[model samples]
Target chain A: MIKFSKQQLKIPQMSKPVYLVTGGMSKFDRAIPEKRTEELVIDAFLEAAEFIKKSPEELKEYIHSCYYGHFADHFGDQLLGEAVIHDRLGLDPLGNVGIKTGGATGGSTIWEAYKAVASGYSDTALAMGWERMDEVPTDEGNHYIASAADKDWETPMGHIYTGYYAVMAQKYWQVFGKEEESFRRTLAEIAVKNKGYARMNPHAQSPMKITVEDVLNSPIVADPLRALDCCLMSVGASCVILADEKTAYELTDNPLLLYTSAGSHTLRVADRRDMDIPLLPNESPDQYKDLGVRFPGGDRYPGFTGFLAARMAAYYAYGMAGIVDPTEDLDLVELHDAFTISDIQSYEDIGIRPYGEGRTYVESGDCYHTNPFTGQPGKLPANLSGGLIGCMHAVGATGIMQVIEVAQHIWGRWSEMHADEAKWKRFNRVKPDDWTDLQVKGAKRGLAISHAGVGSHVTATVLVHPDHQLKGRG
Target chain B: MTTQNRGTVKVENGRYRVTGNFHYAYPNDPIRDESGKLLGITNPADMTHIHAYGGEAPFFENLSNAKLLGTKCANPKCETYGSIYIPYRIHCPDCLMRNEEVDLTELARKGASVHTFMITERTGAFNTLEKPIRFVNVEFEGVSTILMGYLSIGEPEIGMKVVPIFQTKNPTFTIMDLSWVPAGTSVEDLPEGFAF
Candidate 1:
């Protein structure tokens, strides 16, 4: 069995605190034929400046350094894309670096910027991420994405990334789900819920008022995973400004305290060796001793059914943010719903539910904006911005968008940002007539999980209003 | 247009001796909306990439010989000394030491079982596999990790026993050269160019 040294499991301690001053996102769509990528990026930046009641030039002055996240240069046919964006943003003279970690590119960018601000290297920093997946045809785009897998081993077999996830879904279905018909419908409910929530999101793509039956009947891309159960291939830009305490207060009176942590595992799932399940703060050591007995072939810690990277990321984040039980300590969360099964997998990985019981999180309606059972606010609402399923999976921009979505709720501005008719009209999208306001009232703290292909990379970003900051924050 | 003179490479004098054309260029096409509004241009091109397998070269080379090559960690001082890996890891993940290659053909033939599987009708660009591809993750006895491969014949079910098949005839020298089928699949039922 694999083991971790004490040094490897140490909670990350920052020399100084970092805060998120402001963030923004551009209109997301399957394709944006009207504007270039740079124009979309500029639009997102202008929105960030306007949110803080400052001019673009005024906000630009606070950025001491920049971190740009743009995955797959081949997709855009442009190398040094970050340099091009940096030049266009007029932050040329400052030190800047490019970050790419497949699907976790956006969160990795924020992690870098948070470190820069925390280390006193920069008083303020800009973490910007974007993706342009529309340049290539859908099949060719899938090829580009599958390139993220091991080039020699995994990529050659059908060159489809979904098939890789499909294998894991099959294992999870049999072992944890017991291949139950009710379990299959429970997975469908996540799609229905996320898409239904998307109707209220102006910047979302693929907003459908679909039912669980519609999801069950949609064309199956891979067995047990229908087309609607998958995430959208989108084009958009998102960005956040992180700063030290003095600079943050100088920029905005109310800035959320931010803590970002990252973890990684073997790039190829085939190489993941068996190990003991790393316990989260909320778990007991012997809580999973009978896992293999309970679910045959489930003894393997992460064997096709779990994302160890997400678990490690949450393990570190919970310690750093003093989050003992996510269900009780956090107000809301935005998880990477790359696929419906992977979404369920993440619920267990991030400690929302114990292993083999992720279906309960959705079935019990605890993940909804308003729990259907009690007609009250969900104990912990999840993916209210529709996540990657109903929203956009714009690769480099996705994690940043999730963090911004969570921050909006805590800022009590989710309705202001999502309900404005003028903003929806500017993007040429019709506001849904039943656009229910989904603002989680009195939200004080939240989290966002950014995950990469399979379980290679994951990052957890926790944000807390200063007044509601939990104790033991580093 | 099939190009008979695609690029090929060989090592000579400690350097790559490349031959023939490696890239093909095509004219760009305009992309427009229904109103004929200019949107973008499509740049079409084809190119070949020469990739070296390095230390993992033996695994691919052995596939056509009807042999399965895996690696075992040989460092006794390491935490996972005797752990064996398929998909051929060149180094022990725990100790960063070179792994000793081991033949797993007999073991896989006798003991490999399907851990999980999927059948996908969709594939990405440049895929050569047949439609409705059945993908399986096969786990062998005593092996710490499972290996992913396509099933050459029959539907896959969890816990179903399977045996390895290799593209011994006109092999592509890729991971595609290796496949799996039901344990009792006869030689006549094998796919073209493949054998047990």
Candidate 2:
């Protein structure tokens, strides 16, 4: 029993900061038929613990709580996932909860663990995300993924996840003048580039070197989105260890301050009226009366507001981290690139460029290893780990994998056995003698963005190197 | 080629049959029902729906009668914002207050406009026909919620006027029982009391 204070409490001047000391992820593959979800989680956890130079005993004693992120329990033929994982790992009697936010499960789990540490509820917490997608067949797996959408309307109407994105792509083409040839070319470039990057990442599931022509030749699953445009359904697990500033310092010399934020919209895509309407209501219809189109209605196409939730989340994260210009300030980014078009959308959503200019940004070759715009080496490389497109998309693990990639960039740990030398050379252009060149040189700040279920829920996290100078902070 | 005597083998009909203790890797087994039947749910009937909460009972009941119903938020502030929910939300999401049931039968007659639409070529449980299936997001008149249904007649165009086409024969008493067709298109076996 606890006694409650009736008096008003004063808020603290500064909240405790949370840091990610180390992170680990299993190799993303199509199907690890023999490995169970619990086994995969344990493997990732051990690797994360090893990264912090901690022994098994130390890890068992240090972690105060655990948060597991899993999607589609039926896919794995398991329930009470967190409890099973905890018991299997012999971390019982500790606080644990399972989080499900579709594809953003990993990011949401990290956010929950960050809160646990920031609020002084726990000093150290483990965030693990895993999914066993290979247990089911392709069509069944698709059905499981589509379950994230509105079952009452979207699912019953035969709106598969890919079909929904296809519709959005179609609408985008209709409204934004179908530069079909150029638009398709740009999309192909994205697929080719990401896949090309994946060829260097040993952990990536699809590391085959592909070209723009290869992408164009691929069969169209959904119109405008070819087979190469989508990510492979992968089975894998990832873990990130979050601790208070003190614990993080004790764990590792290099620590990354994690600032995470999330935003949600209607679950159903049709409910996203923002896609066709202005952000701010048009109260002054007379102001635009002279315009040919209806003043109040404004433009029927507002350029696909599906990524608005992600934008909102990123805005909150940037505000917290005091980052105004993300494209210039952040050294690198790891975004959810489940689909090639999704990567293009993330560029605008994460403020790399203004709305309706994602095509221009990609075409400029800014997202590549060497930017044509600035001519700077490794200028704002997005998805250095092959992303979900080149890398495999393990739904639950993808968000955590993004965070891990950013952490590796910040810590200068790109030469870790998994980094492919040839692929690295292709991306960076110059020959590298050591691990330093494989990383974003002098990178102090990075961002990781993730979303779930047709961009209905989004999470954006800004990570800063502990020693980096931050504005308005001593 | 010379035969290896080290490995155990038996010959039958000029073909060598390996009889050694060889390890064979088997793929993960599929889930089966209690009766040992492969429960591969390809059709929609293989799935089950359990409506534990009765909040949506009225909405489904109204659908069977060729009528549409919505819930109006009871809170004054919510009502001021013109908040009404289809599928009949029992409580207002914004105000966190109970909502009053509202009959939207007349609004259904007026029909809705296609807000957005998609033409899918792939076959699925709902899109069973070989031809393309046009799914539309229809926004009803004066209703905030957008309803999703298939376009039964004509092509799907943005802002195209469409009306609900309820199944008068053997209604499923589910949302599936209702679809949408181009406005003014004759619908056979409509409910006697309805004026659509």
Candidate 3:
């Protein structure tokens, strides 16, 4: 591991070293039924490339490198659709190298881009992720992913991604004392909020506002989780243009900054790790105790109130954002609402509210975009752009979108952030000085948190607003 | 399209076995062999193995070549009684592997009854037209791979002992190679309009 100058790592509470020039992207998947993966990647490229306003050759010259994020298992799907980048932008092939990680390939891809800029490796680099999942049949697609799973223990048990997570959800329900309805409520809220948000994003794969009642009432796909709770089958591509501060100022008037972002992952097995979706291994009470779930009664972890990955990702995020206290500090937040329960659980895990008290935040109306329930000068308003549930996650791109979501709101790009919420109003705003006693006061930071679920593996990240902006954390 | 309903091969008393769902096919198509050689083919003997389980392999170790195997549920005396399956289930599906080690044994390629069938005109990867096709769910004696496949015989009847014919190229004994035949062949009492 390379060591960074201690000064570089030392982020001042109010201001930070970094400033984002600009990041551009296309919809999650642009080639659903008609185009090739190339078209999908090109869609995002053309979009961000347009912002450069440079001739084809000129844009190519600016791209220090290209990192293609993909999850295709075979050669045909290996590299990112760089063929499009070469043909359209006329870039040399050397810059394009396929970066493959499991489901979070996109999140990791963004992480990579973040590092590239911070390290001065690339003044302007294109981080693009794309997939044409619908081209293949469902069973065929499933077979490809299932091939990635452990063939020895999992495949034999007919463990699809669903069953693996289902088992843990079952176990978590039993361990936590949270009610199934509570968890369901959380998930449904996420789905509904996302649906509402997607309606604002014209490019969203599936854009339609649904109600929590509708989500809970949808057909149960795997016990408590309904078909709607799952992410959609998507073929989307998203790109983010990263530029150093000097380059960004030269390009655009308003540059979105990437203050601070951190990511971490755990083991991918139920037996190898003892964590559940709603319960961190280090957290109090086992899944059985928390959910009060019994093997019988057709209920699994019956007590889980929300998601586990949400809490973990949010925890790391709160730490990174310098948010020692959440309820009264964070001005605005966006968590990957892959499921609605994730949002509610995020409220508790991120310390927005006390444990088992997320419901209170919701009930008191301080936790929602419109609530400001705490009314403590400033309350943390969350998921103004819906989230993954709102945006319809396309695996890798979905995670990247979470980062984009928070940044858009901080930069006040909400009009272009989500189409449905184009006229969407900002929910809650917290004054820095009034935030729960965690700082020297007068710290304006916009915090963005993201969580991803790959079977059961989850990653959380926290992003802090830079030192230049020290009014209140947005 | 098939489903988890594929219990075509059964395991009983810890030994696995199956019955053949056979069919017939005319070869010499434009297809080439592994060596890419184009040879005109026409011989029953040369094509008969195409109808056997796993072809040249003894007892058809890998019947995936096209053989249809039948056996009882891995768990005998299940709550639903003796349900049949194909693809050799390791245990009772209802019990989801909870009940293991039911006995499986092979039986004659003949059948004892046909539970039911559906008539349709589907003719492609999807069923969307008004043509004509018949799908039958048949049962054989003792062995349990409640066979689901295409039926050529007209108007199937329950309890009628039926025989299966098979296709020629790469047969390896799956139900596609098999068609239904009358329990007893008699020229003196031929049924009117009975097509071969």
User: What's the lDDT for all of these models?
Assistant: 0.93, 0.71, 0.48
Pull out the clashing pairs in model 2. none
**Could you give candidate 1's per-residue lDDT for residues A1-474 as a string of tens digits?**
268889889999999999999999999999998888898899889989988999999999999999999888988899999999998999989999999998999999999999999999999999999999998999999898889999888888888999988999999999999989999999899999999888899889878999899999999999899999999999999999999999999999989999999989888888787889999988999999999999998999899999999999999999999999999999999999999999999999999999989999998888999999999999899999999999899889999999999999999999999999999899889998788999999999999999999989999999999999888654
Residue range A1-474, candidate 3, lDDT tens digits:
012245533332422233444445555432344445566666666655554465445555666877666666432343435555445555566466665555666666765666676678777776777555654455445545544554332332232344334433433333332346765576566576556555555455555557778887887654455667666656677777667777766666666555444433322332121223343323454433533233232222112233444454544444444455655445566665554444555566656664444556555655455444444532555655545555555655655655555566555555543433322222111122221211112323455554444323344434444544333222
DockQ of 2: 0.14
A131: Cα error in model 2, Å: 0.3
Listing candidates in order, what is each one's chain A TM-score? 0.99, 0.87, 0.73
Ranking by lDDT: 1, 2, 3
In model 3, the runs with Cα more than 4 Å from the true position are A1-16, A28-31, A49-60, A74-89, A174-177, A180-183, A259-266, A272-321, A326-329, A342-350, A353-367, A372-378, A416-474, B1-196
The number of the candidate with the highest TM-score is 1
Each candidate: chain B TM-score = 0.96, 0.66, 0.41
For B89-144, candidate 1 gives per-residue lDDT tens digits of 89988898999999999999999999999999999997889989999999999999
* Residue A165 lDDT, candidate 2, scale 0-100: 64
Please state the CAPRI-style docking class of candidate 1: medium
Evaluated with DockQ, which candidate comes out highest? Answer: 1
Sorted on TM-score, highest at the top, how do the candidates line up?
A: 1, 2, 3
- CA lDDT, candidate 2, residue A387: 85
